[model samples]
Target chain A: MNFQPYRSPSTGRPVRAVLFDTFGTVVDWRTGVAREVAAFAAAHGHTLDADAFADHWRALYQPAMDAIRSGQRGFTKLDTLHRENLDAALRHHGINPDQFSRETLEELNKSWHRLPPWPDSVEGLAAIRRHYIVGPLSNGNTSLLLDMARDAGLPWDVIIGSDMTGTYKPLPQAYLRTAEFLDLEPGEVMLAAAHNSDLQAAREAGLATAFVARPTEHGPGQAVDLAPEGDWNLVASSIPGLADRLGA
Target chain B: MNFQPYRSPSTGRPVRAVLFDTFGTVVDWRTGVAREVAAFAAAHGHTLDADAFADHWRALYQPAMDAIRSGQRGFTKLDTLHRENLDAALRHHGINPDQFSRETLEELNKSWHRLPPWPDSVEGLAAIRRHYIVGPLSNGNTSLLLDMARDAGLPWDVIIGSDMTGTYKPLPQAYLRTAEFLDLEPGEVMLAAAHNSDLQAAREAGLATAFVARPTEHGPGQAVDLAPEGDWNLVASSIPGLADRLGA
Candidate 1:
């Protein structure tokens, strides 16, 4: 095992903690959400394109967060955002909201919490955790991240999410506040994400960045973020590959 | 195993999370602080009553928090409070401020982060965590709790502390905010504490309460809270015993 410290590109400081972008980087949300939707639709005697539904629901993620990030909407947790987006998607797809009971809607909304980890996620996280503090650095609410951690058996030393900052990713406060809460400098913490845009924002916020490609994060036809677009501190094909690069 | 749900006294709801009063309930801070102080003083070629010093330092805790609770002072994290109190204690004990370098003083202040958990703490917490969500409901700052957990191998699912709420315990906001952050009703969360005052305040805030006897939390001559004072939901001799009572 490589015991050498992983150095940051800009500051040249040894990385202390590794924070992850949860949705596409750590968990296979696309597959998990589509599978759950398929099962729910089948059980309800409804015939719908579950995959398209999952894609449409996820597409609203950024716009919902954008409203709050731009101060056009008040601060609301991601769970609430998910529920609103789900309702819109159901209406858009010609599914009557009244067809599903409140309990069923609530369960369906929790698909984010029930996301399965990527194949290498659990083992890779365990490896990196042996060397550095590991936790999510996503826009997900505290409760959602906690529930997902429990469900996926992810070993996290801490949970740092946008809920704690009242803002979403690409916002400096989200990255800066996570470092402050963890009692570390922004340069000392590295944001390991599967998306280049996340790493770009993290870099701009003065945090070290690592890119792990998730070519199918947006499903089979996913085109963007298929490879590192910028000079990230580290780039790997999978989470375990990143762990290997870090000598974890 | 009982496999029975633990019900709250007032709300009659099944408990979902067990939040601990960390300092004295799960860890023996008095002993740990005394030991570290003795070692530091000895190394610095000074003779002092380490136990008295520990007690004196702890005695300032409530007043410091009271200042914030009453709005006399703005919110400050516990680590900052510890540093300010440490400086005052140094002068009170006749230690020249110049005698110790800044690094040494800073290291000494971190003694709180290295506290030793009670003998049953690790095992008991592990057992209960298997059946319920377990974490510290502490006034200690997030960094302090994280450091202690890493140092002592305390298995915690989440770290809920005063830092998150910007207030101290026995305050309704402290208890209420924790439940809000965890996405649970107050009655679904139980405050497992060794002190009657903490449990009483939590109970009054609509949370379930569990009393565990830590007769020596204040050291050998401890007098208060040696027995359960009120009609708590569950009272046990130790954390493991509490787990058994809760059918965890």
Candidate 2:
């Protein structure tokens, strides 16, 4: 069996395009959004379910992203998806329908863009960016990804969000689409992710995988993808370290 | 007459997306490609008419881009467009058909990808990237743009080349389609360039215009677009200064 390795020719290194798993890789949503939710609740003088709401919102991600992938629904941006989730959250909180204006809903939806970058994220991406073209192959739609980039000062060479592919990550189509968008073969792109499952999937599609452990991606004590499993092409402790290892 | 200002919120400081005029704005196609043509001819031990070929090939751009835009031809990428031009040039140059293989011709077509970046391009873009979602909205196809970005180290957040929009710049739909593809309102995107005609058309169509004077865009002794002609939002001596003025 011939195994195809995704490597860059510049340094005889594996991978040219480092496609990131955005939600948990670059930014921490749990704590960031939880605090905002709590504060928004507090400002409203209401005791509401912040954690549950956050979990509900995150839970809807796949199903919503799947709608497009399955061809059940037309393409929709993440902002609209977040809006759909927020409207239900508001209803669950028993808030009066007329209490909040469309402006309020818009601002709340923007919270996703405000999530704080991981301690190593900004510095890490900057370092990787010097040598390789780093972009997010995220489930986040283009608008959401673009907004997040603006809010967090993420210096991405391109935005390979799901909106472009009309499919979510873990699908070979999604990975292939990123490579195609970058005008590279699948073997030329490396999926630099914090999740083992994402790596496993990209590997199956012949994309090189680099694991940057985000032990706290799901929050402390979560322990998901705490280590690389199977045979990943490269593994690094952090994004900057990954950059160094990749000759960035 | 009240002049409507061009600004896109998707890009906060100015517009979310700033479309560029490719031929002269992003790449110095005439000089760049002519230089490559000269080198290729020398390597092949043939007297290639570099200047004649460059002019003849460029003359095919508008009709080709327009054909796609007008649906006279289905969406053909710039690679295909360039290859078609090469075929025509090869016939005109009376080059022997057996002299080059199909793959060789394809590789030669990629000469456009290696176009040299203008002196201030990288730094100016680095500065501009601080604020805008920089990408070329040229008649060049996505794959061509992608390779160009990688080869020249151009930092583009998206590659809205001709193939994606099914048209070329200077066409209202090309600029309009770019904003729509990014899911941005026309008012939220800016068309930044050195061409007055491009800026004028963009301004007319509700896109903000930023003019970065490329005094030698038409090569030395060029007298066009010496200064801002249509009251563009910002006029600067260089791309970096444009970045600074935009406070990117």
Candidate 3:
């Protein structure tokens, strides 16, 4: 076992915590959500593009967070936002929302809470955890993240939810406050993410950045986040590959 | 394995989170700190009673937290308060504060972060964690709790530090805010603590409470907290006993 510290390229100092972007970086949200949505559709006697339905729901994520980031709305849990987005996605698919009971809607909304992790995520995080504090630095709420961790077998040392920070990704405080909560300087906390924009924002917040690519996060023709668009501190094809790069 | 949900005695609702008090509850702070203090004293050529010194340091804990609970002081990390208290304890022992270097004082303050868990803490927490969310809901800061969890092998699903809540224990917000963080109803969160005052505060805040006795926490002749002092939801002689009662 290598006992040497993992140094942050940004500060030339040891990285104490390695936080992750959960949705696409650590978990295969597209596949997980689509599977749940397909099951929901089958049970409800509806036939539609479940994968596209998942995409439609995810497409609303940024705008809802942008509302809070722009100060147009107070901080809300991602669970609540997901519920609202679910309604919009149902309407977009020409499905009558009134047919669904509140309990059913809530269970569907929690599809995010039980998303399956990427094949490499669990082992990669375990390896990294042996060397540093490891956890999700996602926009998911604490409860949502906790449920996902329990369901997906993600061994997190801590959970930093958007509700805990009262902000979402791409916002500076989303990265900075999480670092402050861990009593670490931003540079000593590395953000291992799959999105270039997320990594860019984290870097701007003075956090060390690593880009882990999920080429199929948006399915076969996924165009965005296909490569490292910025000069991230590290880049890898998979989380375990990133772990290897960190010598974890 | 038991699949039945653990119901909170307060509201007869299923409890989802089981948070703990760290010092003297999960970990043996008196013995742990005394060991470190004894080693420090020996290395520095001092002949102080180490256990007494640990008592002196711990005796200042509540008063320091009370200052914050009363709003006489703004939110401060327990680490900072511990450092301040260390200075007073040093002076009380007739030791020159200037004799210790900043590095030495910092290392001494971190003794709290390396506390050894009580015999049942690790296994009991593991058992309880398999059934419910488990973590520290202590006056210690997040980094302190994280370090202690790592060192003590306390299997936690989340960590609710005083800094995370921005208030010390016994404050209404301290208990309420932690519940809010987990998106759990107050009754859905149970606080298992060694201190009656903490359990009382949690109960008043509408959280279910459990008392685990640590009769020797303050050493022989420890009179306080030897038995359950309030109408706690559960009472046990050890953490494993508490886990057994919860059917975990």
Top-lDDT candidate index: 3
**What TM-score, over all chains together, does every model reach?**
0.97, 0.85, 0.98
Query: Each predicted complex: what DockQ?
Result: 0.74, 0.49, 0.88
CA shift at A89, candidate 2, in angstroms?
2.7
Candidate 3 residues lying further than 4 Å off, grouped into runs, are: none
Candidate 3: global Cα-lDDT? 0.91
Query: lDDT by residue for model 2 over A56-76, one digit each (tens)?
Result: 777777787778777788878
Over the true interface residues, superposed, what is the Cα RMSD of model 2?
A: 2.4
TM-score of chain B of each: 0.97, 0.86, 0.98
By summed lDDT, which 10 consecutive residues of candidate 3 chain B come out lowest? B1-10
Q: Which DockQ-derived CAPRI band holds candidate 1?
A: medium
Q: Mind sharing the TM-score for model 2?
A: 0.85
Q: Lowest summed lDDT over 10 consecutive residues: which window, candidate 1 chain A?
A: A157-166
lDDT (CA) per prediction: 0.90, 0.76, 0.91
Report residue A237 deviation for candidate 1 (angstroms).
1.9
The sequence of per-residue lDDT tens digits that candidate 1 reaches over residues B1-248 is: 55656887687898889999998999999999999999998998888899999999999989999999999999899999998899888788888767888888889999999999999999899988887888899999888998899889999988866877778999999999888888999999999999999999999999999999999988899999999999998999899999898887
Candidate 3 local lDDT, B1-248, one digit each (tens) = 54887787567889888999989999999999999999998999998999999999999988988888888999889999999999999999998878889999999999999999999999899989888899999989989999999999999999878887888778889999999989889999999999999999999999999999999999997989899989899999988898998888
- For B1-248, candidate 2 gives per-residue lDDT tens digits of 34223344423343666666666777777788788888878878889778777777777766777787777887777788888888888778887646788987887788888888888887888777656677887777776777788788787777776655656667788888778767777877877788888888787777887888877765677787898887778788777877776666
**Candidate 3, position A95, lDDT:** 97
- Model 3 lDDT tens row, A1-248: 55876787678878889999999999999999999999999998999999999999999999988899999999988999999999999999999888889999999999999999999899999989989899999999988999999999999999878888888889899999999999999999999999998899999999888999999999999999999999888999987898888888
